[model samples]
Target: MRCAARRCAGRRRRRRARGGRWRRPRRRARAEEGRGLVRGSSTPVRGAVLLYGLLAVGAVTWVLADRGTIDLWRHPEPLWRFPFAAGLAGGLVVGVVFGRIVAWLSRWAVRRTRWGAGLHEEFHALLGPLPDSDILLLAFLSAAAEECFFRGALQPTVGLVAASLMFGGMHLPVNKRFIVWTIEATVLGFALGALFWAGGQLAAPVAAHFTINYENLHFVRRYRPA
Candidate 1:
């Protein structure tokens, strides 16, 4: 009788999931979008287009304005050393450590502050509908494109402070409680700038940024449903 009861419950749960319980969170996120609490259209296709468009712009800007040179670094190298292999390895390590730090801080915020919890929910709502594959793609693209544009092309043109400020402004808050994201991004931009300056190439900042995004976005995808 107990075994039969367990089977019945499992069947009922599957039925409920099929009945849309599994998609409730996504629907709720869409509803929030309707209400204007969420920003931007969050579809995977749109996201890809936007990222690629930025990448093209970066490439063009890099060719024209910067004259294809990177004198902004503390020790600028010949463009022949494009990969910067050592910096990539070191930046990967730094990215992992920084990701853990940010994760710890985010958890603390969610647990300790009411606003933090709400902001967390807000991100979920905005990002809930993405498939796991899309999360990975977006993570890589966003990191690569952002680092290319901000650290690679723009920094050499405008200098660190100006470039970092623009990067921060690009991630401005969605709401009052979400100001923390903007501040965090700004600090991260500067850190990435330092990495660029030290490593003397775009590879380090791109690798580090990619690691951080992969960590955080995968975490978001794996978050327990509320």
Candidate 2:
């Protein structure tokens, strides 16, 4: 009877020890999951705040700059009558074509070269896991604010070349992708500037910008690696 009691006590002790070992790992895993959830939730908030902040700043700057020079409500018709409907249709077509070409080139480059793949991955990381809705909003707001400031305000004052250069330069940051991004931005700036110049109104460039951004955002979100 004494021997049986002693064995039973030993078994109980061993079981408790085994249970404790399993419980510790389970607790650690739960803590890690909680941390991941917090990070995932916070990232979108930060991205939205940054995008909206840019929109607000751009809007204020445009308002201040164009106070008397360019009336948002009125513009003298160009000698060549580029109707608003025609401009909108043209902008949409051009924007879609341009966006498709850019996306195809980017994807091709990513598949072809290690450097391109690395850049693609880096950009994906930078964008994070933004939802489709947030991405759409960001693209639209960015297009509107940037077009208002660059095409609506700055281009008229500084001329197309200067405005486009400034637009390109604005993208330069102390990063590995700065030069590439700057060049791409410069080219895009020129295209948008030309559209603005041709249409003689903010509508064309704004539509084009929005279209390009929206398409690109969707492409990146859909094709980015898991």
The clash count for each model shown is 0, 0
Ten contiguous residues minimizing lDDT sum, candidate 1: 70-79
Residue 208 lDDT in candidate 1? 66
Q: Judge candidate 2 against the unseen true structure and give its global Cα lDDT, from 0 to 1.
A: 0.66
Which pairs of residues clash in candidate 2, taking residues 3 or more apart in a chain or in different chains? none
| Candidate 2, 118-201: lDDT as tens digits | 666766666755565556666677777777766666776677899899888877745785466678789889987877776666
Please state the error at residue 218 of candidate 2 in Å: 3.0
Compute the lDDT of residue 116 as modeled in candidate 1.
Answer: 66
TM for every model, in the order presented, reads 0.68, 0.67
lDDT of 1 by residue, 1-226 (tens): 9999999999998998888876898998766544311134366437665766777576556746657553332224432343557656666776667656666676677667776677777777677745555656666777777877777777766788998999999888877866877887899899888777766766567666776666666666566434
The best candidate by lDDT is: 1
Poorest stretch of ten by lDDT in candidate 2: 70-79
Q: Model 2: how far is 148 from its true place, Å?
A: 1.1
Residue pairs in candidate 1 whose N, alpha carbon or C atoms collide under 3 angstroms: none
